[model samples]
Target: MSRPNILIYMTDQEQAQVSFPEHPCLMPRTEQFAGEGVRFRNAYTVAAHCCPARASFMTGLYPSRHGVYNNVNTHTAIHRGLNDGVITFSELLSEAGYRMLFSGKWHISNHENPCDRGWEELIVSSPGDRQSGIPPTARWEEAAKVSNDTRGRGQILRPGWGHYLVYDTYPDQGPKGYENDRDYQFVTAAKEVLPDLTESDTPWCLYIGPNGPHDPFNIPERFADMYDPDQIALPPSYHDQMEDKPRIYQRQRSQYWDQLSEAEVRESIAHYWGYCTMMDEMFGEVLDALEASGAAENTLVLRMSDHGDYCGAHGLYCKGVPAFREAYHIPLMARWPKGIVQPGRDSDALISIMDIAPTLLDLADIGPIPEGVAGRSLTPFFNESSPTSWRDTLYTQFNGVELYYTQRMVQTQTHKYIYNGFDFDELYDLVQDPHELTNVSDRPEYQDIKQDLVRRMWRTALAEKDIISNPYATVAMAPWGPGIAFE
Candidate 1:
């Protein structure tokens, strides 16, 4: 069998439900792609932020091992980039004789050249003026030098309701021209480059990362007009009273979305939906290019987002420091027309972004997954047959890039436990409260469950080599617990 060419289509801050098969209104092309591929119902990002998530996506290692604790860009200088010692999937793919290409955001590290990590070709999307285009600092000390000061450039925060909004028409209006819009440029490059690469003898891998459906929710007027703000539906958890939720949740609401009236929240959600449709259109363009190139059959395609946005869920705007399902659970789909005999199935297996590297490497017939690679290969889940052995729980971690906070989470089929190192821990019974509106952690009845989850988190931390500093020497005891028996 001939080796397949790989195309990874990645978006920023996209929710799993936006492109879900049930809702084809927002991202029609993605829904169609899912119809021809397998959609992971419970896919998640190891970390909820940009740089850490992207680093895990590339290296197949958790943020703890990869060493990217936060977003790596102009603003975050303290933890700027991925460690140089880590090996990325691109590097291994390149070594395996595939032509590797990376376009769009490579926020992995402040490494001078991406070529060093294996992509021979790189086209960095300009982080437009609205995004501040704030250049990254040279070293860790520089972060303290300009604490919270975007180096004279302004922050991405807009004035109204703390939701970043630019109420303007599109096309050549901003510093980055509409024609030069990052997403447009990324698609244009892919359209122009894909045909030739498909025709080449060597199998090629192209990683396309587009910054979209994120915030600054400004989009072309056409898409912005798609949904009427009055008609937009609010998330069930939008008015989360913030009752049993942690202080961080309260602080985030006060800091960002507390002032937002119902109308403003609806309007923001409308803009977000519009932005999603616009991103879907861009994705359609690439699908058109692939079909035109006649390489659709031989190409293995992956579509996913780095993380999800709050989009008014829990009265929040962007991703919160806490482990909210809206922020961490994301869309993940894979399509290989020639290889996958039976597609259009949904797998409930718990998976993470870190799995992408190992899965892709496996699909490409690359040998022995690198030692210390922390993700499982998902190739087995492609077929129609169900695997007897699969993970019942999924774990994720979050640490602040701007604010130093530690949060680790372990989610089972029915429950979720979030340990906030600084404040209160959160335990949600998913079966009872799918929306995660209540926190049952402090309840005496659920102490056994919470204790078991805490032990799980500790074991996971040790397995992943995560550096979680816990003051309680109690956790140092048995793998299960003290006198408390694990149910």
Candidate 2:
């Protein structure tokens, strides 16, 4: 029998709920994919930013182990490169005689490129302003300096307004123009690659990662008109002031909130939804191509995102600080017609993006992941016999000096605990405080609850080796605090 093909479809910054039945975004194609597969309702990204989360997904290890802790950090080998001796899922599959191809964004390294890491073919975008038009050498040098800032390291700087030329093709500028155009090009690339299928004897692993619905909030004209700005509802946690919360959260709100008005926020969200819808359309084309190539039934399809976007939720504009569900929880759907025992079922069990590697290996009937890989295979879940051991809590961490400093969180089905090394601590019963507006950490009534959560937080850190000693332990909050206040 021929080996099964694998297609991992991913989006940059998408919230898990956007594809939910009630979300404002109409994703009929995605909904159809979910209906044909198993959807993981509580899936989360290990880290709430791009690079680290992507690294974890690729390596099946936590960020701390991989050493790509933030988006701006440039130590690519294990830091920039995949950690020394670490076996990437793609590398393993390639060694097993599979064709591995990577298309779209490759933010893993400043020095080493993704193609060197076992991807036989690569079509990618560099980090930073997508339209800067700077040469790779100059762009890397400039990016390195900017990332040296205490907080900016390891994060992709927001793009400025201009014509974005994707992979040196398709110049897109202005609202409702660039994002959709880029999606069109991505779809076109996938279509063009289909002819290669017949020439190869080995099965393939194709990763299509689109950078959309992430920022610049642009969409096609028709898609932008899908929803009225006035009809969009702001999240319940959208407070005018951060009040009694961590100082980092307040700082971030001040920086980005003013750039948008109430109407603009809604419009941005509507455009974001439009971008997601466009992504769905692009994915549908890919699915059709798979079927046309006679590769549909033999291929395992997995769709997910790097991380969730805030997109005006909790009075915040983007993802960085504030590790809320809107920023950490992401949509995950898997379909393997040859392996899945049940279709169209939903699993609420906790899972993370890192699990993708092991699951892929499992579907291939490969042996255990080399020792040291932290993620577990999800094969048993698809088989309808729940795994004997599964994680009950999910964790995320962020380290940004400008927006925040070293914040970590532990999320369970009923509650969430946020530990900020710099400022106030927070705990919330997600069931009672779904929006996470109320902080129950200091409340006397929840004292026992708080202690239990703290223990879990520490346990997770220790298990994942994510803990770091406070380097600035002596710095107290100055009366006025440090840095210029926007307000």
Candidate 3:
């Protein structure tokens, strides 16, 4: 039997709920796709931000070990390298003779392109709006100049478009067009590569990473006007002010939300949904091409997001600041016609994006790459009728000066415990308060509960080596409350 071809379609900053309960955008296609696969309901990113989370997915390591801690202060070379001891799943697959192709965002390393990282073919954009200095392709340069004229910002000087400048040039192509922006470039590259797939007998892996719904909220006019701003429903956390929260949360909210109005927020959400829909349409195109090329039945299709966005959730505009559910939770769907046991099933098991590599390795019948990879394969969850003793807790971390303090959280089915290695600690009874509006860390009645949670968290930290702590010692800390203050 031949190894299954792999197609990973990843989106940037898409929330898990965007396609839930059949959202207006992408819901139809998403539902059709989910029917052919396993939909992981509880999947989350190891890190809330882009670079760290993406690096973790690529290398199957945590942010601490990967060393791509944050977005602004970190460089890709600091963590990922061609000669670095770390080996990516793509490299492993390529070494095994799979033809690898990558299109769209390559935020992992500035030291080398995806081709250097083992991809046979590569079409990637810069990490972020930081100017690449490497002149873009003719189409990209033309788009940049047009974008500059549209925004009156002199030139499209950024590597990727920034959020603050939404009134910029519009992207005409949906997913498969000749437009030279990152999204269209990815689609065009995929279309160009499709014919070759039909002639090749070797297993292939094509990564399509789209930069939609990330920022600038500027899609083609047709997609942008798909939804009316007045009809869009705001998130439950949408508020004018996030009172009784940490100072950092409040400051972030003020910085972004204070400048926009209720209508504008709705408009942004609508535009985001439109972008999502456009991406979904693009997915359809890719799938169609795969089927036309006779690779559909043998291809393992995976759809996921790097992290999540905060579309007016908790009075926040973007992601990376607040560790709320909207920012970390992501959708994960995988379809393998031959390998998957149960199709159209939804598993609520706790999973992380980092698990993708291990899962792929297992499907390809490859040996474990190394011992340092923190993620485990989720194949068992897909095969078993009922998963027993599956991961009981999910962990996430945010480490950067921008976040003010390094924070790690351990969440179980019933409770969530957060430790901000600085001044505050948070405990939430997820069963009772699903919204996580109340912090019960300081309550005297939950002292025993807090202690037990701390013990469990310490054990997890020690086992995962995610945090350095002595399990023998007990944590002695006061509870954070409404009156408690932080800088």
What's the lDDT of the predicted structure labeled candidate 2? 0.67
User: Best candidate per lDDT, number?
Assistant: 1
Model 1 stretches astray by more than 4 angstroms: 74-76, 126-180, 405-487
Q: Mind sharing the TM-score for model 1?
A: 0.75
List pairs with backbone clashes in candidate 3: 129-159
**Error of model 2, residue 303, in angstroms:** 0.8
lDDT, candidate 3, 1-487, per-residue tens: 5799999999898888886756666556777888888999889999887778888898888887777776532321233422357788998888888888888887776566677678865577654334344421222223223322233331112211122443223656544332555686787788779789769888889999988768666678767777887888887778646567766576444433555666777877887888788787777777888888877887899989998888778866557756888889998998888777879888888898889988888777889566688888877866864566677788887774332445667688998988764445799999999999999987998877776666566445434544221110011121211011110
Candidate 1, 40-59: lDDT as tens digits? 98999988788789889998
Q: Please identify which of the two predictions, 1 or 2, would achieve the higher lDDT against the true structure.
A: 1
The CA lDDT at 482 in model 3 is 9
Best by TM-score: 1
Q: Which stretches of candidate 3 lie over 4 Å from their true place?
A: 72-83, 127-163, 166-181, 401-487
In Å, residue 440's CA in model 3 sits off its true spot by 32
Off by over 4 Å in 2: 72-81, 127-180, 198-201, 401-487
Model 2 Cα lDDT, one tens digit per residue, 356-428: 8888777666777877677788877778836677888776656443223556676889888776655666889
